[model samples]
Structure formats: structure tokens, C-alpha cells
Target: MTRHEQQSRLSNVARVDSFSRDTREFVEASMRGDGCLVRVTHASVGSTDIMARRGDYLLHPFPGFVSGYDFIGIVEFIDRPAQSLGLSVGDRVAGVLPGMGAHATRLRVPSSLLVPVPDGLASEDAATLPLDGVTARHALDLLKPSPRALFINGVSGAVGLLAAQLAALDGVRVSGTASPASAALAMQYGAATFDYGDTQWPRQLLDQVGKVDGVIDHTGSRTLNSVVKRNGRIVRTAFGGPVGHQKAATAAGFAKTLVQRFAQPSEVVCSTPMYVAMKRRSYRRDLTKVLELADSGRLKPLDPVVYDVSHYREALDAAGQPASGKKVVLTFGE
Candidate 1:
């Protein structure tokens, strides 16, 4: 089968085990299999983690598994036949795993899953990329937006920013929702800025942009009134947003709403949804592209709001707070 086909097949088959208290064993771990042991320097708290932490995710149990995913750090140990892929004992790297474990000071993971951090990017900034970068790419591939025009709701968020920049690079006209503080940054990456802080942003978007061919929506169920093409496609990335997804799709009136999930061989995440998600053919190339753009300054750098791992409670709290934007990270100090 072709690579895309292979990726699509894997997407339906790659199951993420539901976290039970037993999975808590992953926390306080030192090594796994023959993977490389990393000395994590910084790990970012994603919104999913926040929802799970606060007992808000309907699917997640209270006080859910460790709250992290993407991380940037150095290699501390590598098991025998010492991993190849150009990884060394001191190489700086970035990675994302399917589930929890990144919140800890250190963890063991395969070198195959890691992308080497370029010379000048900060660890905290790099920490923000694994989840956001990969997720943006994954969402867009599923959205398959035309080269004409695209709109991103909640553009100030990290995934939205990366999605805007990546789409803009391919010659799509991009518009994004932002606040006054984040407007300039949003535009710098090539989005026509719209102030979501305005109560009537949907109307405002209708007045300015007219209609877009596709939308990457993070606004939950808040519909885009008369702003999308007759059959515009939409990819909804926010699960814990203000409104439920079915209502969001109904309100927005999208002709094609993409529903994707990373599930198991026999596991059907949602049947009524009648959709499934896929994994990448390879992410090393995507990671390489992101790092190259970051190093050359084509992509704007994120100044992460950092916390020492020793003070994880505060970091977790900060990630749940809206004041921090999308750049909160936890540092593991020397």
C-alpha cells in the first residue's frame, strides 16, 4: 500500500489505551524497553491535560494521569546498540508520545520518535512544538484545504498559529482570531487578524472576509455565520471548548466536517460520528521543516511561560489559567 494509505490504516488501528489508575505506573518511571533515557529540561502543559486535571473531560477520570506530552531535553542514557538516528548522549531533542509521562523530570523513549533541536532554538520554545506542530499538520491534512482561502478560529492559540503559518507558506490566504495582545503576532505569521475578544466576531468575520473555503475551528460550537463557502470543509480541534462539537458543526453549517480519532484495532471511539483519524506517514520531515523555519526566523518564536518542575503545582495551575496564552512550560533544572 502507498504511504498515505498505510498512515490511514494505522490511524484506525493505533489505539490509545484509556487511562486507569494502573497507568499511573508510567509516572515516576526511569526507563522503558531499550529506549533512550532523556533528562527533560522543559515540558509543555496542553489543554487536554488541563481538562483532565480539573475533572472537566467527560471521558477522563478525576485527577487523571500525569499531565504532559511534548518535551524538550537532553539524552542522559541510551540502551545498548546505543540508539542510532544520530542521537548522542548530549544531544538536545524534542518529542511527543501518544499519552502521559512527559511531565516528569525524565523518561525513556525511542530515538525514532524524537527530532533533534536545532542549534539556536530555546528548549522551552522547542518544547511547545511536538504536540502543536504535529497536530496542526495532522488537522490540515485531514481538512485538505484548497489553495484559495482558510480561516482559523482561536488563532492566538499555539496550534492555530502554527497551522496559519504552515498553510500560509503553501499560498493559502489565512485569517485568524486573536486578541489585541496577540494580533500583531498572528499577522506576522500571515493571518488577516480578527479580534475574537469582540462579542460579535462571527458577524465581524462575515463583514470582512465574506467567505472562506475551509476553516480550522477551535471555537467549540460558536458558528461562523455566513462566512464559509457553500460546501466549505471544517476541522474541529478543540474538544473542551465552550460548546459541544455536534452543535458546533450544526451551527456552522459545514458541508464536510472532519471527524478523526486515534483508536485501536477493534476499538471504535465513536460510531455515530462515522469518522476516524490517521497518523502521519512520517513526522521527522515535518519536525525538520518546523525546526528549519524556526532557526531561520521564518516562524516566530514562542516565549514560554516557564516553571521549575519542583514547582509543578503552579505550572499546572498556570496552564489551566487563560492569562498565559498557549505557551506554558515546565523546566527541569540542573
Candidate 2:
């Protein structure tokens, strides 16, 4: 497209707004990037977007808090010295905002939070990379797994799949519980699959793949002491609440239990989305490495259930609804 064509498109840019049912307007953000504008082509509606729409995420709700985390887009503008990062206008890029705001056509991304999306990777695929991949890598970095087997509960979900594959890369044999439909795909990512459809999956896992070195629980914090060995690590990055996890952990009597949560620079967290967001600057190395693997067809890429910005409501609803593997995304800047 010519400069005139691009200019005309920018003047009519559309973006999804706050999750508040009352004030959820389709508004526009600044077209200018102050030398840092990202024209988002794909933005993922993650668990945070789903929960925020229900008005239950943040303790104090604001009127116009935009709902989203990860995004992939062409760099439309670059005001600062992004050349150091090999970034320039028209480069495809991916990023995660620590606070909400990626669910828009235009995002004013800082240089520190952005990375060039590898050539040949789809925006939808890269959109899943920043938040979930960073999360999976961060957890493994903390765990430092060695030639041991770990079971990932809820293995078919976005983060679980990434963690499963990454754990395998780090020499941990990965096993995970998934619906029978996704059990094969989970195995493709190197997890020994146990059918979650079985009401007795815990027992099934023990009988088939005895004695896990650790467990990554994404099932609303249900403890796995019944299947995990003593002194084994159980990491929770699930949704809803951790009340069930707390109860299960205490009742099951594990020697040590780890609850991964939002992290700060002064501390480290495991297996949580916020862990990636806060560590965006520090996580650049691993983030680039994973996207490289994706481009080379060596990593398990997320398949997105994409919607246009006009279907924002359906997108949010789909995001909240039960699904396996594929994440819900909103696309703009066509």
C-alpha cells in the first residue's frame, strides 16, 4: 500500500475497548506511536480478558481499563532508537504489556517490551508466544529440571502445552492429562498422555506412568500428592481461584508446595502469566530463542481461534468458554 493508502486506513482504525458492559465502546487509540506505534494485526484474549469482562480481575475496577495482554503486529512507527534491537518501521513484532492494553489496533509499545517476530511465523502464532512461551520458559528456568519426568495437568491448554514442550527440551520427560481428543497432540509435544476424561485419571496416571518427579497443575489448583512423590514440586498457574489448591495441598499432605503468582523484580515467581509480563525486559533472550524455534518448525505453536474486532463480545465469550489448545484472538489492521 502507498503512504496515502496507509494514512487513510489509519484514520479509520477500530479497536476493542474496556470490558465494562456499560462503557465497552469501540474506540480509537492514537495513530502516532510517538515514534513507537504498533499496528496490531492479532491480539489474544487471554484468561485475564475473560475474567476482566466479568469484572472480577483487579480488586479496584476502572471505567476504561482495556482488556488484553499479548499482541503481534507490524511496526508502523518507531520514534526512538529501536535500531539497537534491530527494529524498524514495518517489522512484525510481538509483545506483552504488564498491565492490560494489547486488545487494540494500535498499541504504543515501549522498546523494552517489544521483540521482532521471526520471519514466516504467523501473527496469531507469535501473539501466543510472548505471554505463554515466556511463562513456560520462566517456570523451567526456576525448576531447573534434570532427566526426570513431570506430569502436567490440563496439558492441552495454551500454557500447559508450552510448558510441556519446554520441560522436554530441558531433559524432563513430560506427562500430562488431557481430553482424549487432545491427548495425541499433547503427546506430539513430548508428553506421555493420560486421559483426563477418565474420572480416575489420577489412578490411571499412576498405573501407567508411575512416580512423577513433579506436577504442573492447571486444574484450578487441585493438588496431586496422590500421584506425585515426596519432596516433589507442584506448581499452580490455573484460573478461577486457589482455594481448592490450598485445601487439596494441605489435605494431601505434601512435604513442600509452591503457589506461583504475580512476581516483582525483587522476587521470582513460577508458572504464572504475570511472571512473564514483569520479566519482559529480562526475558528477551529466551523469548527470542523460542520464536526462533517456532520459525524452524521445532516448537509446538498455538493454534488460535481468531475473530475480528467487530465480534469482540463473541471473542470474549469464546475465551471464557471451555476449549483445548487454541487461544481466542481478536484481529484488526487488515
Candidate 3:
């Protein structure tokens, strides 16, 4: 569709809040010089540290607490500032920004900040990839699995689930921990599953699966300490508070550190040669594998708790709940 046509179609949809408002606003402000209207394609709410206070920066630096990023829809409405950048309709794009009004009816974004989505992926699924997929890929790269036994503590999460599958492809003996429901889903993704609350769960897992060579601890607890082998490596994603830090230190020793934060897709999507290649080729390969797993009844997209855009607060509330599945996503349509 032409950019004008796309804009006309989007005008009919209702606007809702998204997590990446500031980033989108910043892009939109810049694009206003050229006259572009950006709309969000898809967004997901997962665990983020936007609540923790950093040096002089509120964790959510954006308006409200909208902190998220996703695939965005860009449209050219008139001959304005953004036109000079040469953006066209049907261009697959991705970005990282706050979540709020961005997911609503319309968004204005800078032409320079968007990157093309890989061919063949749906916009909704594409939106989830840049952040969680990249994080999982990068973390697994650090481990460089060569037949090592790996454990993923929260295997049902978007990142954790994808990471477990990726690790299995690398010849790692993947085992995932979760509640019963999530554990079943993890097994479908080719990982051995262990129930999180089994009092003898850790010992049972260790007995059946043996000691793990690496651990991806999304839970941030010391419960799995008994299962890790001596001198084994661990990568943790739950580094939020002082308590989390102390627990990480106690469990993994000084090596317990947060995975290096990756740049927003707006920044790294074009700069990283590997990501560019992955965007062109590997992303499809991996996603196809995920889809195949799903089609063969071996994997499934974690069922999202859906909410209307107007109830963004409720969506966030749902995301915060102790659920075994994935995120609470705000949708414009039922």
C-alpha cells in the first residue's frame, strides 16, 4: 500500500498507550520536520527495570512509565520534513521506545530511526523479536555451547523460551524450569522440564539431568544453586535490587552479572553486521524453526493475556501477575 493509503487506513483505528512513547516522540519530533505519521505494529510487556532509580534518571525516563519498543508502522501523509528521507509503504520496520500512545491510532516517528523487518514474519511476531530474541541470542553466544548441559530458570518467558530452543540447536542439553503448565510448554520446545515448586525438584533434576555446565537464571533466586556444577557459569537476567545483587553474588560468585544491555533496534539494527545478516537470513531460519516446532505441536507462542489499548494500566497489571505464561499485550482488535 502507498504511505498515504496506509495513513488513511490507520486513521480509522483507536489510539492507545504503548511503552515506547518517548522514543517514538523523539523520532516523531525529528520527523515532523519532514511530515510523517508513525503507527505501532505490535508491542509486548515483559519484565523491565524501568522502576529502579538510576543516576539522575528515572527508570522510565519517558512520559508516564511507558517503557517498551516494537515494530512500528510509518506512513507519509503530506510533503513535509520526513519526506526527504525516502521512506515508503510496506517497508518492514522496528524500533525501541516507550509504550503508550504510540500503540494507539497514530504515531509520528523519525524516518532515520526505523529498520526494515525481515521478510515473511508477521508484524506482531516481528515486534517481539528485536529485543527478546536479540538478548537471548547474545546471551547464548557468550556461552558458545558445544554439547554442554544448560539450564534455563524461567523457560516460559519470551526470551527464556526462545533461548532454550536456540541452545538445543547448538547441541546443548537444554533443561528448563517453570511451574507445571510452563514446564509442559518448555518440553514441547525440546527441553527437559522440571517443576519449580517440587520440594525435591532441584535434587530430582540434578539426579535425572546431572549437573549443568551453564545456567540462565531468570528467577534470580538461590533455589537452583544445588543443581549447578562446581565452577559452572551462570547468566542472570533478574538483576534489579540490592537483594538481587547479593543473591547473584552468593550463587554465581563474582561472575553473576547482568547480560550487557543491547542497544535499541533503532541503533543496533543497522549497525551490527551479524544482526543485519540475521535480519536478512538467520531470523527467518530461526523463526521458521520456531514455527515448525509450533506446527508440529512441539512449540507454541506463550498465550498472551490480551487487553484493550484503553486499559493499558490493566495490561500492565496483568503483566505483573504471577503467571506461568507470557506477557499481557494491549490490542486494538479482539
Candidate 4:
């Protein structure tokens, strides 16, 4: 369905039959038989890609697959339904996929999964918003009635930073755990920061801000008992453990974290409770809201460190470094 004449190529993350490991290599890929085809300009590098590469993500696929979650691109072709939604060829767009595939040079995705990127927003900034921004929104959404105070774990992280900004916009008091290097950045987003490297950081937060009305915890369950007030809400975004471990181990760890969180007197929830079929309408709406916030300068995205698609390995390595506060992104035709 593509209007472009050139063939499509992608960095395929080929997985073993045993699902024990994966390797990346360039391969030919065709546009989806259905949906619109996008000429990908920039794609995000996230921990999900790292986890998928290691076969540790809970939804890791069998056989082999492409391994990216979000992308920004130009619409090269559109179906009637896409046209009905007001999309046109050459319109800049950004979106996240239900499964991994955005790493490639071209993508065939449903029109409902896509959102228009605002004109003033750079593609690199738009690239980081889809996955993390929606996740942060989901986390905040779980806090019914809207808590007056919020504490986010991993405040320097992609999701945590966006959550901080969104929470601040709602006039919520925000405090979070961050590395010393990222503390000032967190403060810029209206969060009081504590050094997570300190074992007593929980106490530090308690001393400075008292118990919070809610917690968006990406680290694990261990911090919940101390930071969250009794009966406060909890949104669990990540499980505690290494990313390159076995799938069984990852599931086990996730279950254990759930049990621990539920054991608390507080209300425990998950940003993504399960990996069911995606609701394209809801995803498109939330992504649109996040993009608008960024466009209006209400939610400022951190400047990402961009890399060419050819230097993907270096980008991955840089993303894994603990001290690097910036998001890593891959570009095509730059």
C-alpha cells in the first residue's frame, strides 16, 4: 500500500527457537497488507527494547521480531479509513505500537494508532513522548480523585520525568528519588529529589515531605511500605530485577512484587495491569493529549541524545548507563 517506490529494510531482532537469546541484523520487510505505511524518520530506544533483546520482557515473542516500541515519521500512504480520520500523505505523525516493530525504516500501522505531531515540536522530542508519556498518564490516571501529593521512584527516568511534569501541572506536590546528577532536573519539573543511592532515602523523603498521598513506583515494592501513606494509591510500572534474565524469572519477579504490593494496606495497581489487545481509540486519545501538552510547553521533554541508525549498538550501551539522564533515539535518513 506504500506510495513510495523504494523497498523497505529493518533491523530485525532475530530470536532463538528456545527464546533464550536474540541477535540483530538488517533484513527486508514489506509494508503490512492493511493499514497505512509510514516513512520512519526517528525511533526511540528504551529499556523495553533492551528487555526484549534479552528475552526478559513479559511479552517477549517466539521465533523472531523487530524490536522498537515508538516512532515519529511521515505518512507515505493512507487508506480510506485513515483519510476519514483526516490524515494525509506527508503529514508528520508519532505513535507507539501494541507490539515491537517501530525500529525499521518503514511501518505499516493502523490509522487509530497514530496521532498528529504538532508543527513546532521537533521529531526527536516527539519520538520520546509516545511510550513513556502514555505510561505516565496511565499511572496518574490510576490515582482516582487526584492525590494532592505524589512521589515517583526513578524520577530521572523517561516515564518518571514526564509523570513529574504532568503531576506538577495539576498542582500536585511532587517528590521523587533521583541520582545526584538528575536532582536539579527533577526540581525543574517541580519535584523535590532524594538520592536513591542512599539506603536512607526513604527516610529523607519522609523527613522533608512527609508521607505522600500516592506513589508512582518504577523501582519495586520495597519502597511502597515506607513512602506511601496508609490507604494511599500505588501504581506499579516496573518489576524489580535484572532485565536480561529468563522469562520465567521475570514473571515470577512480577508476581512476587504484586503480592508484596497488595499485601500493603494501600491500594496497589499497575499502569498496565495486563497485555490484552490494545484499545486504539484510548491510545490515540492519550497520545494526543501528551503531544498537546508538550507542544504547549506545559510538559517539557528532555533533550534526547540522538544517534544514527547504523550506530545502534552504541546508542543501546549509552541508554543503559545509570548516570545518563537523556533519552537515546535512532534516526533514519539523517
Scored by CA lDDT, what does every candidate get?
0.63, 0.68, 0.52, 0.76
Top candidate by TM-score: 4
Tell me how candidate 3 scores on lDDT: 0.52
C-alpha RMSD of each candidate structure in angstroms? 9.8, 5.8, 8.5, 3.2
lDDT string, candidate 1, 1-334, tens digits = 7985443222111012343322322233223455787777888876666655544444344453455667888887665544557778898888776655577666677666677899898777777777778767666665564537888887778888888878877888899788888888788778888887787877777788777877776544436525666666566665333523333333333322223122110001111111211232256666667877878878765668887766666775677674413578887763
- Candidate 3 ranges beyond 4 A from true positions: 1-37, 49-58, 61-65, 75-89, 98-114, 145-147, 223-226, 240-300, 304-306, 332-334
Q: What tens digits encode model 3's per-residue C-alpha lDDT throughout 1-334?
A: 7986654544322222243322222121212233345555456655452231121122334333324544345453423433454446655455543332344445555554445554554555444455565556655755544438888877877778878877876778898777886778777778888777777878888789888876776544556556766656566654334532433333343233322123110001111223433353444334334444444544344565666666665665666563754555655441
lDDT of each residue in 1-334, candidate 4, tens digit only: 3643545423233223343433544466555556777888998888877777766777764646677888899998887788777899989999887767888888887887788999999999888788889888878978867899898988888888999889888889998888898899888877888898899988888888888888888655565667777768777777657555545555765676567565554545454423213566766777899999999988887678898888887877776662435688888862
Query: How do the candidates rank by TM-score, highest first?
Result: 4, 2, 1, 3
Deviation (Å) of 112 in candidate 2 = 0.8
Deviation in angstroms for 37 in model 4? Answer: 0.9
Stretches of candidate 1 off by over 4 Å are 1-31, 62-64, 79-84, 197-200, 241-281, 323-326
Candidate 1: lDDT of 7? 34
Question: Native-vs-model 1 lDDT?
Answer: 0.63
Clashes of each: 1, 4, 23, 0
How high is each candidate's TM-score? 0.74, 0.79, 0.61, 0.88
Candidate 2 residues lying further than 4 Å off, grouped into runs, are 1-25, 29-35, 58-63, 79-81, 197-199, 220-222, 239-273
**What does candidate 2 score on TM?**
0.79
Which prediction has the highest lDDT against the true structure?
A: 4
